[model samples]
Target: MKLMHVDASPKGAKSNSRMLSGQFVEMLRERIPALSVDYLDLAQDPPPHVSGDFARAIYTPEEERTPQMRALLEPSDAMCRRVLAADALLFAMPMYNWSMPSSFKAFLDLIVRGGVTYIAGPDGYAGQLARHKVLFLTTRGADLRDGSPFAGMDALTPALTHGFGFIGVRDPWFVDAQPLQFAQPEERAAGLARAQAELAMVADRWAADVMSEAA
Candidate 1:
C-alpha cells in the first residue's frame, strides 16, 4: 500500500501535529512492513493558488486549451495526479484562527479539480478517486470539544472532512492536540499528555488492524 503523508505546518519539527502524524506513520510502517510512504511538506514548498487561466483551462476541452492555459493548469494536474496515486492520505495541519493554514487550503484548491478528483454527472456529483481512508492530525491553540465555550468553532475539521469526502474519502480518523494556549503550564502539560496518549492509542489500533488484515 502507498500512503501520502502531508504536513502543512510551517513550524517544521516543532509542530505538534507533525509529531503526531509521524508517530502514526511509524506505527503503520511497523505493522505493514511492505507499505511505501510519500511525504509532502507544504511549509517548505507551498503550492501556488489556482489562477483564472487554470480554472478556464480545466473547464475548457483538452484539445482546445491554449499554451498559456496549459501552463497554468500543469501544476494543479500534477498535484491531483499525486493524490490519485495514493491509497491512503495523512494530513497534519495546525488550526489557524479555527481554520486550516492558507497553504493547505491552496493545496486543496489545486487538487479538487473537475475530471480529476470529482465530476459532475447525471447523479449530481461523483468522485473519481476510489480511496476512502483519511487520517487528520490537528493542533489547536484553544479547546474546542463538545459543550466547551469554543464548541463548533473548529472550522478546519469539518472543512477538511467535507473536502476529502467530496473526492471519495469517507472513513476519516481525526486526532487533535488541543488547547495549546493554556494560561497555566500545568494545563498545557496536561493537554500535551492527553494528546500523546491519544496518539499512542490510535497507533496501536492501526497497527493491530494492519496485522490482522495481513494475517
Candidate 2:
C-alpha cells in the first residue's frame, strides 16, 4: 500500500507531532513490509497559496481552459493527484495559536479544489477522494479533550476533521500529545509514552485493514 506522511511543523525534528507520525510509519512498516512511504515536510516545501488565477481557472470548463489557466492550476492538480494515489495519509500537525500553521492551511487551499477534490451533488457536495483513510498526529501546548475546559479552544482538530470530512476522509484517527508545555516532567513522559502506545496499536490495526483491503 502507498502511505503518505505530511509534516506541517516548522519546528523540524524537534516537533513532537513529527516524532509520533514517524513512529507510526515505522511501526506500520514493520507490520506491512510492502508498504511504500512518501514524506512531505510542509515547512521545507509548502504548496503555494491559492490565488485569483487559481479561482478563475477552476471556474473555467476543463476542456476550454487556456495555457494560463492550466499553468495556474497545475500545482493544485498535482497535489490532489498525490492524495488520490495514496491508500492512506497521515498528517503530522502542531497547533499554533490554537489553529493549524499557516503553511498547512495554504497546503489545504492548494489541494482542496472545487472540481478536482470535490463537486456538487444531487444531495450536496461530494468528495472525490473517498475511500482513502486518514490519520492525524497532533501536538498542542494544552489539553483540549472533549471534557476539558479548553475543549473548544482547539481550533486545530475541529477544522482538520471538518475540512477533511468535507473531502470524504471520514472519521480520521487522531493521536494527540497535549499539555506538553505545562505538564510536569513525569507527566509529560507518561503522556508521551501513552500516546506512543496508542499510535502503535493504531498502526497495527491500520496495517491489517490496508493489507486486507488490498488483497
Candidate 3:
C-alpha cells in the first residue's frame, strides 16, 4: 500500500507531531515491508498559496484552459494526483492559535481541488476519496480533554474533520496530543505517552488492513 505522510510543523526536530507521525509510519513499514511512502514536509517545501490564476484555472474546463493556466496549476494538480494515488494519508502538525498552521492551510488549499478531489452535484457533493483512510496527528498547547477548563474549545479538530470529509475522508482518525506547552511537566509527558500508544494501535489496524488488501 502507498502511504502519503505530510509533516506540516515548522518546528522541525522539536515538533512532537512530527515525531509521533514518523514513528507511526515506521511501525507501518515494519508490519508492511513493501509499503511505499510519499513524504511532504511543508516547512521545507510548501506549496504556493492559492492565487487568482489558480482560481481561474481550476474553474475553467480542462479542454478550455490556456497553456499558461495549465502551467500555473500543474503543481496543485500533481499534489492532487498524489493524494488520489495513496491508499492512506497521514498529516502531522501543531495547532497554531487554535487552528491549523498557515503552511498546512496553504497545502490544503492546493490539494482540495473542485473536480479533482470532490464533485458538486445538483443533489449534493460527493467525495472522490471515499475509501481512503486518513489520520491527523496534531499537537495542541492546552488541554482540551473532558472536564478540563479548555474543554469544547478545540476548533482545529472539527475544522479538519469537515474539511477532509468534504474531500471523501468521512471517517478520518485523529490523535491529538494536548497540554504540551501549557500544562505541568508530568501532564505533558502523559499526553505524549497517550498519543504514542494510540498511534501504535492505529498503525496495527492500518497494517492489518493493508495486508488483508494485498492478500
Candidate 4:
C-alpha cells in the first residue's frame, strides 16, 4: 500500500508532532514490511496561497483553461494528484493558536481544487476524490480534553475532516499529543510519558487490524 506522510510542523527537529510522526511511520513500516511511503515536509516548501488566476483555473473547464490559468494551477493540481494516488495519508500537525499552522492551511488550499477534488453539483458541492484513509496526529502545548475549561476542541480537526470527507476520505483517525506545556519538569515528563504510552497502544491496535485484514 502507498501512504502519503505530511509533516506540517515548522519547528524542524524540535517539533513534537515530528517526533510522534516518525514513531508512527516506523511502526507502520514494521507492520507492513513492503509499504511504500512518500514524505512531504510542508514547512520546508509551503505551497503559495490561492490566487485569482488559480481560482479561475479551478472554476474554468479544462477545454476553456488558458495557458496562464493552467500555469497558475499546476502546483495545486500536482499536490492534489499526489493525495489522490495515495491509499492512506498521515498528517503531523502541531497546534498553533488552537488551530493548524499556516503551512498546513496552505497545503489544504492547494489540494481542495474545484472539479478535481470536489465539484459543484445539483445536490450542492460533492466530493469526487473520496477513497482514502487518514491518520491525523496533533501535538498541542495545552490540554483540550472534554469537560475541561480549556477543553475547546481544536478547529483544525473538524475542518480537515470535513474537507477530506467532502472529497471521499471518510475513515479518519485522530491521535492527540497534548499538554506539552507545564510549570514543572515532572509534569511535562509525565505528559510525554502518557503520550508515548498512548502511541504504543495505538500502534499495537493498528498492527493487529492490519494483520486481520491481511488474513
Candidate 5:
C-alpha cells in the first residue's frame, strides 16, 4: 500500500508533531516492508493559494481552457492526483491560533478542485475520492481534549475533519499529544508515550488489514 505523509510544521525537526510522525512512519515501516511513502513538508514547499486564474481553469471546460488556464491549474491538479493515487494519508500538524497552519490550508486550496475532485450530481454532491483512510497526528500547547476546560475551543480538528471529509476520506482517526506547554515533565512524557502506543496499534492493524486484503 501507498501512504502520503504530510508535515505541516514550520519548526521542521524541532517540532514535536514532526518527531511523533517520524516515529509512526518508522514503526509502520517495520510492519509493512513493501509500503511506499511519499512525504510532503508543506512548510518547505507549500502549494499556491487559490487564484482567479485557477478559478477560471476549474470552471472552464478542459478542452476549451487556454494554455494559461492549464498552467494556472497544473499545480493544483498534481496535488489532487497525488492524493488520489495514495491508499491512505497521514497528517502531522500543530495548532496555530486555534486552527491549522496557513501552509496546510494553502495546500488544501490548491488541491480541492470542483469537477476534478467532486461534482454536482443530479441528486446532490458526490465525492470522487472515497474509501480512503486518514490518520491525524497532532500536538497542542494547551489542553483541548474531550473533557478539558477548554474543550469547546478546539477549532483545529473539527475544521480539518470537515475539510478532509469534504474531499472524500471515509475514515479519519486522530491521536494527540496535548498540553505540551502546560504539562509537567512527567505528564508530558506520559502523553507522548500514550500517543506512540496508540500509533503502534493503529499501524499494526492497518498493515495486517492491507496484507489480508491483498492475500
Candidate 6:
C-alpha cells in the first residue's frame, strides 16, 4: 500500500498533530509491513501561492504552454502527480485561527488543479481521485466540540472535506485533538488519549481493508 503523509505543522517536535499523525502512520506500518510512505513536510518546503501566471497556465493546453508557463506549473503539477499516485493521503496540521494553516491552504491550492485533479463538465465538477482515501489528523487550541463555546466554529473540517472531495475523495476521516492549549492538564491528557484511541481504531480498520484487498 502507498500512503502520502503530509505534515503542515511548523512546530516540529512540539506539535501535537505531528506526534499523533506520526504514531498513526507507525501503527499502519506495523500492520502493513510493506507499506510505502511518501512524506511531505509543508513547513520545510511549502508550495508557492497561486499567481496569475499559474491560473492562465493550467487553462492553457499543455502542448501550447510557453516555457514560462510550464515552469510556473511545475510545482503544482508535481503535487498533483503525487496526489494521484497515492492510494491514500494523511494530513497532519494544527488549526490556526479556526481553520487550516496558511501553508496547508497553499499546498491545497497547488494540488487542486482542474484538469489534473478534477474535471469540470456541464454536469458540474467530477473529481478524479475517488479511488483514494484521506485522513486528517488535526490539533486545536480551543474546545470546538458540541455544546462548547466554540461549537460550530470549526471551518477547517468542512473546508477540508469539500476541498478534497472536489477532487474525488469521499468521507474522509478526521481525528482532532482539541483544546490542548487552554484546557487543564488532565483535560489535555484526556483529549490526547481520546485522539490516540480513535487513531488506533482508524488504523486497524484501514489496515484490515488494505490486507483484505491484497489477499
Off by over 4 Å in 4: 205-215
- What TM-score would you give candidate 5 relative to the actual structure? 0.94
Ranking by TM-score: 6, 3, 5, 2, 1, 4
Instruction: Show how many residue pairs clash in every candidate, following the order shown.
Output: 0, 0, 0, 3, 0, 0
Top candidate, metric lDDT: 6
Q: How much is 51 displaced in model 5, in angstroms? A: 2.4
Residue 58 Cα positional deviation in candidate 6, in Å, after optimal superposition: 2.1
Please, what is the TM-score per model? 0.90, 0.93, 0.95, 0.89, 0.94, 0.96
lDDT of 3 at 148: 92
Pick the TM-score winner. Answer: 6
Compared with the true structure, the alpha-carbon lDDT of candidate 5 equals: 0.85
In model 6, residue pairs whose N, Cα or C atoms come closer than 3 Å (at least 3 residues apart or on different chains), thus clashing, are none
Candidate 5 residue lDDT tens string, 1-215:
89999999988778999999999999889999888999999988977776777777888988999999988788888888998888888999998888888888888777677777776779776776676778998898877878989899988888888887777766688988887778788878888888899999999888988889889
Q: Per-residue alpha-carbon lDDT of model 1 for 153-175, expressed as tens digits? A: 88888898888788877768888
lDDT (Cα, tens digit) per residue for candidate 3, span 1-215: 88999999988888898898989998888888888999999999988988888888999988999999999988988999999999899999998988899998898889888789998899788889898889999999899889999887888998899888888897889999988899899999999999989999899998888878878
- The lDDT ranking, best first, is 6, 3, 5, 2, 1, 4
Q: What is the lDDT of candidate 2?
A: 0.84
Model 6 clash tally?
Answer: 0
Flag the better candidate by TM-score, 1 or 4.
1
Question: For model 1, which pairs clash?
Answer: none
Better of 2 and 4 by lDDT: 2
User: Which residue pairs collide in model 3, if any?
Assistant: none
Give the TM-score (vs. native) of candidate 6: 0.96
lDDT of 6 by residue, 1-215 (tens): 89999999999999899899899999999988989999999999988887888888988888999999988888888889998999989999999999999999999989888778999899999999898978999999888999998997999999999989899999899999977898899889999999999999999999999988988
